[model samples]
Target: MTRTAAIIGGGVIGGGWAARFLLNGWDVKICDPDPEAQRKIGEVLANARRSLPGLSDVALPEEGTLSFHADLSEAVAGATWIQESVPERLELKHKVFAQIQAACAPEAVIGSSTSGFKPSELQQGAARPAQIVVAHPFNPVYLLPLVELVTAEQEVAERAAQILTGIGMLPLFLRKEIDAHVADRLLEAVWREALWLVKDGIATTEEIDNAIRYGFGLRWAQMGLFETYRIAGGEAGMKHFMAQFGPALKWPWTKLTDVPDFTDELVDLIAGQSDEQSGAHTIRELERIRDTNLVAILRALKGQGWGAGALLTDHDKRVRAATALAARAVDGVTPGEPILTQARAVPLDWTDYNGHMNEARYLDAFSMATDRFMEFIGCDADYIAAGGSYFTAETHIQYVDEVHAGARIEVKTQMLLGAGKKLQLFHWMYAGERLLATAEHFLLHVSLETRRPSEPGPEVAEGLRLVAEAQADMPYPEGAGRTIRRPG
Candidate 1:
């Protein structure tokens, strides 16, 4: 069945929610009263289009078209899920829900992106409370995977969970309807502590952020608070850690439940502090930095299969490999038969002469094949980063047939010669087994730090020797065996 999502409100959060659904291939309908809503949503979509693909391990799901509606009733008419991200006003929420109820299907779930409002409070006296649930997501919803779900109805909660899980999110069902939900309550605790730190002149805003990010945040990356403390508890465990630190709770340290007075002076001071912390960069630059850091952190977690790892893993499942190389391993293939690399599509930027793939793209495709070949020989990034790099010394190319833009091409690499210090590689590009181009090259191992020719480490050498021995009986391309060329 085709899935569709309706988002009410075109604010930052609404736009983000729309992006999340749209990128996951859900058709989105947004209703907002703001005159500039379309422009604002478009801008958000532009950024999302660029960043979402990078966050995805595979190509994104089919993108959904975004439509705007002036009428709330019109927007939710046929949506599978209705997300209301209106301004956090009780009366406004009530009005929207009343209108939404009239338009949305009885089976479709209605979710509010309300940060602090409980479902009980929002659904007070409504004709149908079970259909309405809190689907509160953090800011920058397109990147963050956490969504707090508050609902009394098991069916509604389960349905919401299914939708959220489908889109690669961690939807935690709150056992009870709390004032601020789980994540926000934790955030409130941190916010209060941050305010106290600034009010007491103990640290600047940046200092507090640095203190958390550099210290505890790094620990939290792999292990949450309880887990970290459990480790600190040593062999004794959580009981010991709690017993040792529990006494600190008795001290006059914090007003955790107390809300700070929203005085003008205090607001000004905090605003000034925020400006001081952020004045150096524009919003776009800040977003770029945030996305880059998120990508790095998520990529790191991909290895550990932690917090954001689930999303990355889900992305990998949906990603279709452009080439067949990833489908199977070349582990024991005899050397004479070409080792098939993955199928690849010509990128939009690689088109040139005669509206076909530029001659250089064939080389690029061969280069990727070389990387896979290196990985097969156990010469991965860590090895290269640790003072070892491969230097291509020679190349011969024959463009037998033209490949146009968007065409899928495959490469088959054959080893001409594999010996200590030098290995000759020959690659052929094919459009479904029809030869399109051929490249023959020679590569030498080099010490990256010294940039000088060097023999690969024994482990790498042994691995290559195994591959070479296996391929020994295979016939090489007629002109495959060639002299190793030296780079100038």
Candidate 2:
């Protein structure tokens, strides 16, 4: 059964929440009085659709339905998750909570996307205070996995965490709620220091941004604060580093506790500097740029299986399992037929200057297909870890058509020969019915310990025997043995 999520505001954050849930196969109902809510949310959703699916190697679930409602009650009618992303006004939040609780299911998770307000403050005089929790997400909620879940009720927090994880979000359950929650408090300190820097003419907006992006920001992205400092301690650990640098905390190195006057001069100065720095691109362009960079960073992290990338890896496993279950339910895999190995969207990074998929990505996609095929034939990670694996010896690729970023692509693999230490396969890549490319790969089963060709494990050999026997009568794929030829 498809779950339903109600977005109580259709602005950037609300639209992002809607996109996240909807893309994860939850029907979404948006409630916002703004006449432009539909357009705004549509724009956000468009960015999401182009970027989010590409984050995973496996294809995401089919998107659920999206609808807008002017009436709060109608929107929250069947919603299992209701996210409140209204402007940060205590009175306004109370009013919205009252309205949401009145209409929404008592069991529905009421998540507030408030950066500063505590759950206690939000739950004040609510119909069901326990149902309300803080689920503050960063901007571009579709891509970022972190959601600070703050609540006093452990049951509600646990339920919310499960629901958020289903939608590819990391719910960091807070033990106790404070004025500004964890991340924002840290961010506020940085913001305050940046402002002082600007106010003192020590750095411009761009310089401050550059200082972070080009410097410690990269370290912070992967290792975070304490771990990075721990490394900085060199032979010693965090204790040594802290003992050396901890005393600097009392020095006048930062104006974090101070605030610049809220004067128009400061505002104008900051805005003017910001415009000078990034006035060339529109907000949409900037958002796309940010998303693209984030995708690249996260994908890189995924390769290493660290930090947020580990979360993505976990999500991909879930996606693969779910996809396999769905496929099995529909039409069980037939042995003789080509196996559907890979189904995914072309990531933004796969494109080049030509605006279509770079030629190299063809092999990359085929490589993933090959990996999937190996798994199907029982030569998975565990098998490799146990000193048995296949190494690609030769490959031939034919690019029949061009595919662009965000295009849904699938790879079907057929076993040509699977016996002894030899494994030959053909892969056909497609976008819908259009043939995008084809690759023929020849591989050798090897022993990782001795680093030489070796007889396959019993299970792997059996799997290969079954597939080869089933596909014995199958016709050879066209252009299977072809090689590069000069233009006629």
Q: What lDDT tens digits, residue by residue, belong to model 2 across residues 60-79?
A: 98999999998999999989
Question: Can you write out model 1's per-residue Cα lDDT over 1-488, one digit (the tens) per residue?
Answer: 67889999989999999999999999999999899999999999888888878877788788888899998888999999999999999999998898999878999989999999999889976779899999999878888888999999999999999999998788989999989998888888999989998999999998998787646775665545654555454455445555566566666677664445545565456445444655465555554544445555665666677655565767764663443444333345554576776466675556775788888878888888888787667687788778886899888888799888668888877776677788788888888867898888888889988898899987678767777776778664755544444222
Output the worst ten-in-a-row residue range by lDDT, candidate 2.
324-333
The lDDT, on a scale of 0 to 1, for candidate 2 is: 0.85
Runs of candidate 1 with Cα error greater than 4 angstroms are 255-488
Off by over 4 Å in 2: 257-482, 486-488
Best by TM-score: 2
After TM-score superposition, the amount by which residue 194's alpha carbon in candidate 2 deviates from its true location, in angstroms, is 0.5
Candidate 1 has which clashing residue pairs, if any? 323-342, 323-343, 324-343, 325-342, 335-471, 336-474
| Number of clashes recorded per candidate | 6, 0
lDDT of the candidates, in the order given: 0.79, 0.85
- TM agreement with the true structure for every prediction: 0.57, 0.58
